[model samples]
Target: MRKIAILAVGFAPNQSEITETISLLISLSEFKAQFKIFAFDRSTPLNHHELYDLESLNPKDFDALVLPGGIGNATHLSTWSNDKIKMTVNPTVEKIIKQFYEESKPIGAICMAPIVVAKVLAKHNPNITLGENFSETHLVEGWKVTVEKCPSTDYITCRDTKVITTPAYMNDATPFQVFTGIRGLTKELVEMA
Candidate 1:
């Protein structure tokens, strides 16, 4: 079975993105893929949610990495002191992503999560999508990466790297559309694995 590690915000994450992605992957019983959730340490115990500490995980143990989209992604995953200011990329997340990239493992990002990917893989200048938004697109382009515009029903897979991205809620897509796109993303990542 292929092992996949999913990164989520330590605080309130996009529950829909995480749950739906896991559900779709689980539905694909034939793929024989196993998944686990990891979050950064907030210096407090997670009482309501069960997640492995991101620091404790070894990227080598997983076949692929997944980043689900949500408001928390921008606030919790990256090194942002406030909504208007981003200091640096999270070292742990950056290290994990770089390890996966160096290993040629696939990485998937959804919605606003692509911003984190763009920062982590800045030198690669990977082609990604975060739906059709002026500001978000501009932010990604600032990283020297190309941001492809995709409909809610479709996803963008980077040509030069094994990075996949979907707009998800960024386009205000219907739940059905988001599910279809995520399923497609999952299938692509599984194939890469």
Candidate 2:
């Protein structure tokens, strides 16, 4: 089974629903995957879901890394909430992203979650998006990434960085459209893995 690490790094309750949606879709796919939902802080669990401490996560153990949607990730896992251009990504989050990136492993981000990845891998300048006219387009300014406006049910997969991104709630999309976009993310991620 392929091992996929889903970062439950945000504080928003809806973030869990998005992550669970990704998990369920992946579970129903043909590729068999074992997931580890990691917590940035073990002391406070989100929605009572037990999370594996992120400090103990080893990038070498997983085939792919997933970052869930919700702007909460930008606020919590990264400093994007306050400093959009000069934001700083969490050390552990940065480490994992770099490791998976250096290893050429797949990394998937949903909605605003791509902000953290784009910030961490700024020098690499990969492509990502949060739909057209994203309210926070200013955040991508100094990140050095090429931002594209993909459809709500579509995703952008950077072949060079192995980074897959989708605009889930980032766009004014329906639940079905969000699920479709995430499903595309999972299918592409597993193929890359």
Candidate 3:
């Protein structure tokens, strides 16, 4: 079985983190072996919700990296700082995420997760535009690029690159509806692995 990692930062009362967990699980169910979840907490704080810091875990053990979207990641990742207040765990997660990308492993980000990818790339290569507008809640900013056989409203996948973005409301969907897009990606991930 292929070992996969679903990376998360904070699970504070936010729609992005909650839906992202649901989306990751729903996607994993279609595969033979579910991914191992790792939550990262530099503060060593307790997460009322589990899987709050999945990204902070070591990436060497997994075949691919999955990032869940949220405003916390976007704001923390884009900015650089030495101050403790501004330098939170999410930024650390972003740095690790860059390492994952540099390793050339498959990464899956849904909804605003793509924003994390955009943010990292923006620091160096600002040429890539996600869309025209920016969202405070979701943290999506750039021209949207979609793929075939993916959810229209809540999901987009970079099939060639093995990166995915899901809608904010994806987890609210019925089980049948939720797995459609994720299953497709699962197949791709497994095949590539």
Most accurate candidate by lDDT? 2
Candidate 2 lDDT, 58-164, residue by residue in tens: 99999999887875677778888788788888899899899999999999988888888998887898899878769767659556788999876889998988899
Q: What is the C-alpha RMSD of each candidate to the true structure, in Å?
A: 3.2, 2.5, 6.3
The sequence of per-residue lDDT tens digits that candidate 3 reaches over residues 1-193 is 7777876554554423554466566667657644765554334333332453544467787788776555545444433223222323355666767776677677776544555565554333322222223333232222233322235133444544555454443234454544454455555655555
**How many pairs collide in each candidate, listed in order?**
0, 0, 13
Number of clashing pairs, model 1?
Answer: 0
Cα displacement (angstroms), candidate 3, residue 56, comes to 5.3
Off by over 4 Å in 1: 11-30, 41-50, 80-87
lDDT for model 1: 0.75
Cα error of candidate 2 at position 96, Å: 0.8
Q: What tens-digit string does per-residue lDDT give for candidate 1 at 1-193?
A: 8888888765444332554444344534446777777866444434544678889778889999988777666666775425433446778888988999999999998887788888888899999887876464665677788889887678899867899988878886787888777778888888888
Compare candidates 1 and 2 on TM-score and give the better one. Answer: 2
By lDDT rank, best first, the candidates go: 2, 1, 3
My TM-score estimates for the predictions, one after another, are: 0.85, 0.89, 0.61
Give the Cα lDDT of each candidate: 0.75, 0.78, 0.51
